[model samples]
Target: MLGICVCLFAVFTHVLSQEAEEPVFYTCTEGYEYDRVREQCRDIDECALLDDACKGGMQCINHFGGYLCLPKSAVIYISKEGEQVPLPAVPAVPVVPAVPAVPPSQPQVPRSSGNQGVSLSSRTIRCAPGYTADEQNLCRDIDECATGRHTCGPEQTCYNTRGSYTCQCPPGYQKNGDHCVDRDECALTHYCMHRCVNTQGSYYCECNAGHKLASNNHSCVDVNECDVENPCQHHCYNLIGSFLCQCEQGYELAQDTVSCQDIDECSFSSYMCQYQCINSPGSYACECPEGYQLQGNRVCQDINECETGTHNCQDDEMCWNYYGGFRCYPRNPCEAPYAKTSENRCICRSQAECQGLPPSIVYKYMSIQADRTVPADIFQIQATNMYANTHNTFRIKAGNEAGEFFLRRSSNVSAMLVLTKPLSGPREYVIDLEMVTHHLTMNYRSSSLLRLTIIVGPYAF
Candidate 1:
């Protein structure tokens, strides 16, 4: 009996489980339907499926399962008899009327709910002074810009506010009433130092030819011409707005002032040279003639080949010094074996006739210091081969016979002369010395030294 009751209980539990899995169906209302997932009836939101169900002049407001239609009040007007009246219905032609503000003198009337049931008169409505009633009979700001009602020009912009609209200029512009004008940014600010150009909306700075804009974008600065490839052939200097070229020493700037030319130093009269001046590329050189050398780069001094041991003189000849050269001649040509003495002339083996020598050859060499009390030997006669068998006689005479010069023999072989007076100025004195060598072995005596002219003076402190 317990097993039978267990079987019956199992069957009853299965039937109850099946009924819980499959729910029953029910009829739904006009505005509600059943949802299979929830297994219940839910109200439908008619506002989402279709347009608003509000009639006449009303606004639709949605709720949990339904929507409410609220009536919108029309613009209220006061009658000529001071009685409140409803706004007239709009014509089929869609006419828009200007709604005026409710006057303070009129009595206020409450708005209608739109469900008059034909038992109530039209409801009163109102708006602010500048506000107008929209299609839903609600107060809204009039968009004069969108409706083409604003008096602003093309350059002006219209802005709508709570109850009215206004016109204003755009950025970088100015407004005067309904008109707009462009703003001059260049004149209104510290724009540029050089030049300012005004564009449509802004301004810019510009510089001249040899200038550049500074880092501040306002002022101008000079361009450094030296930094670029300048046309100058030498040194280049950059100025404030220009450039210049310069040359070094011994050079000059050309006509264009950009190229350098060599200066002809030889053209100047003050050149430090005695003989000749030669111009080089950029400098000059002092030159002398043949057989001469430059002294102190200015004076031309004779290159004494005899004293310098550069002459080709034979052992039997003597080198004589000249202005620019040296000459070699036999020593004492008068000492020939056939030399003789006549009444007043000397005869020698004639290779040439003997003429009086010039003053330079007669003196040979001479030098005297200023203000010397002692005697100074300026000339010495060389002894000849005839001196061994002859007795020499000497006589000296001064060109200026003022007792300025006196002669005496220091020894039998030489003579010594002294200047007794000091020279007052630069003056040359000539002296003649005649020496007669008596040939005791020969039959006659002849004077060999005739004129030995000496020059002195031209000395100073």
Candidate 2:
């Protein structure tokens, strides 16, 4: 058996050498060729060889025995050999088998005796259309797509099949008549939540104002302006496609609505504070002037230096309180013809040894705030000695130069002193009030005097 196998190999080698010496014929498919070194059919790379294999910005993808044209942005899968494969949109193509070599039609007969003659049968093999034979005498499928032998147009892709090829549109395109055209995906389907922009052979989503594109690239969501921009000067609130700003207490929004401004509480009204109104950044304060204190939030009250023991009056001086200040006066405000009877009063007892003078002289002291209302009744006087059926009259005997005071009679024996005009001070006034009584039945008259001192303070609290 081994010797017979060696004899058959030598005969095969001899046949191969004879075939080489003659014209050897190799039948290969359109996209394949017989490799002389490997003695087999191999695929052709049309993409590498043809410069215009893929037109219109399409990418050329080489496959087994064929090639594909796809959009530049199309998604593709990779095979184990690191070759690109078409997406599902493109129809799958079957791999074509390798071609085989064809044997010669006639064989040489060996010259030998009848007993040594080997009868060999002659077999003829032929390939069908779109198929070819390789060195192994096997029929292989043709790749007409890779060889540009298909009927597909420039806008279409060619897929190779067993012994055949089919034409189809690439991704992002649809077949229209004899050509492929771009499909308007944005107009056909509502895939974007906000807005859709149609591109060449594709579509994309967009977002409106105050909205942002979601991760899916087809939906929109709120942008949260407060967190992103922080437009408010003090506080900010975000809403749908808008935002709002707010200020803290004692402040208000400015004209721009994004900034905060101080609200001048003092300018609203004059009565906001009794003394003075002070404005701050976020609030206001009420303040009192010298010698006064704030009573409440907006009122000022006098600081009574005498009552509060904050005065510097000496032992011989008496402390007096006025609206917003204090003053010191002599403990005894009496002059000649008057004797001290109390801390604020004096009286004359003997009346100058019974001469032509009033019988008694009294002293009184009082203080008032500056700018006191006019026509104010300040003091009163009455006859100390009155007889039966007596008529009496009162008068400001002195110190009436500015017409600041006048005496009005209330009854037959009593009268009141009135201030006729407003006075501002740090000032002092002295007046002598006198009264005279007449006994109508006896036809005799008696007189007396009352000394009054008025001190006016500096301010009104």
Among these predicted structures, which one has the highest lDDT? 2
lDDT tens digits, residue span 121-141, model 1: 332224545456565434455
lDDT values of the candidates?
Answer: 0.53, 0.71
State residue 387's C-alpha deviation in candidate 1, in Å.
18
Candidate 2 local lDDT, residue 312: 100
Predicted structure 1: clash tally: 1
Residue 83 displacement (Å), model 2: 48
Residue 107's lDDT in candidate 1 = 23
List the pairs of residues colliding in candidate 1.
76-125
TM-score, model 2 to reference: 0.63
Cα-based lDDT at residue 115, candidate 1: 32
- Model 1, residue 224: distance off in Å is 1.8
lDDT per residue as tens, model 2, 19-74: 22222244454566456555555666777756656543467866565688776666
Q: What is the lDDT of candidate 1?
A: 0.53
Candidate topping TM-score: 2
